[model samples]
Target: MKRLFAFLFAALMLAPAVQAAEAPDVLIRRLSTEMIDRIRADEQLQSGNLARMSELVDSVLMPHVNFQRMTALAVGRNWRGASPEQQKQLMTEFRALLLRTYAGALASAKDQSVRMKPMRADPADKEVIVRSEVVQPRGGEPIQLDYRLEKAGDGWKVFDVNVLGVWLVQTYRSQFAQEVSANGIDGLIRSLVEKNRSAGAAGTR
Candidate 1:
């Protein structure tokens, strides 16, 4: 489960930074290639060194992801019910979880490459699916990577990634909804916060 979360986080962090002047497909391929290169080159990430992996994720990945949007989707209808403070806490904890999980997955990056599929998307639509293939070593089946993209301002931002056809946000949504149902939104937020805190302490130790 942790490894699966890490793979999703790493993929999310590498979402294409679309340029105004470039086609979305071209930009996605370029950014994805660059991210793969960075992962390959980083000694700490390649070696599964946690401290450097954490730093790499914080510096290179976090800025590109829309955590607030992800949190809202994950929290489902409970997002509207939360107070501002609670909303802020939820976003913070969720962000930390992704970052930590991404660091953990850096070890699995070896010999893995992403192949961007041809985009058959309507330019007029604000939202579209961008598909790719993750080729792993050992000659097994390729993992399908589908990114859910939304036009935000002048560029397209990815809100979710589907690995091997399983949507990450949707998976989290189910878990989050269950948590909220069992203990309310506040309880869910508290649980995430405590989990983040515990992970942080464990890393320090």
Candidate 2:
């Protein structure tokens, strides 16, 4: 699961705020290429500078993703039961967790490029799947990576990802559901808080 999450972070790369006019597949291909080039050229990023990577991710990647939707999906049915404030807290903590993990993945990225497969979606569709793979260094087996994106007013926002046939939202759904079941929404929030806190401490050390 951890490896798959890493694959997802690597596959997303560093995407700048996207233009609404760009096609989803085009967006993926362009950003994937850009990220590979940037990683290869930047010594600080290649060395795994967490702070720099985290800042880049916030500025470049967050705008392209629908993290609130992702948090709701991961929380499953419990999403409807939580108060608005709880939902907000959940989103905050969940975003922190993902951001921390993504920063770590970015720092470790080296000599990796993404290969995008042909996407089959109608021009009028509101949601689409963009398929791709990560070509690892030294001729390693390419890992299958896919994205689920929905058309927002500004542009397409990625909501979920699939790695090695396992959808990220589904993978976390069961675990999050268990957490919510055992301790309620606040409990789940506390769990995510502790996780992000631990990751933050570890990164600083």
Candidate 3:
């Protein structure tokens, strides 16, 4: 559960957006506006009182993400070596990890706003870095957010995020590699399942 939540927060730090001629601020504002409206309209989510934030996150945020591609990249060379069954298991676990993560992080979405920085680059570039700040109501300080985006067919998709300068995909790659090395793929799967089960039990209470 902790791992999943970590991943979702990392993702939120770098939300995806189209790579049109539109300015970064315009894209960010559009996404933020849509999200706020969805939050208010969903009865199940609104009544869940933050507990149900996961539902909203899963429905709205998950659609824009490319988790399958992200997982393949994270697995790196190991993905090529994995058998069909192993590949399937890895995808399942990865998806669950993100789902549980989205649920938890959305629950904590208090009064927050995003400030997008100016975009500076040619449209032909294969990648663009979208910078923003997540301002919280508590007034501690704004969190630095950076989205590493890649040009997909007719659009730009987020492949990685850095929060307060910490790159999420890199962090998971290191940790996941260590776990696989220490316990093997089966061991890693077991660990994810156990953690997910525990989180489910807790959510019920």
Top candidate (TM-score): 2
- The C-alpha TM-scores of every prediction are 0.86, 0.91, 0.77
Scored by lDDT, model 2 comes in at 0.81
Clashing pairs in 3: 54-103
RMSD per candidate (Å) reads: 2.6, 1.9, 4.2
| lDDT per residue (tens digit) for residues 66-119 in model 1 | 667878998889999999999998888887777776675666765677788889
Off by over 4 Å in 3: 1-26, 40-43, 46-63
What lDDT would each prediction earn against the true structure? Answer: 0.72, 0.81, 0.61
1-205: candidate 2 lDDT, tens digit per residue: 4544654664454766789888989877877777777777888876667777667766776778888899999999999999999999998898778767766666445666788898999999999999998887789998888999999988888899898899989988998999989999999999999999999899788
Q: What is the lDDT of residue 126 in candidate 3?
A: 82
Badly placed stretches (over 4 Å) of model 1 are 1-8, 11-18, 48-63, 201-205
Model 3: per-residue lDDT, tens digit, 124-203?
78877787776666785877777776766645556766777887677777877877889877776787788778877876
The local distance difference test score of model 1 is 0.72
What lDDT score goes with residue 22 in model 2? Answer: 86
Better of 1 and 2 by lDDT: 2
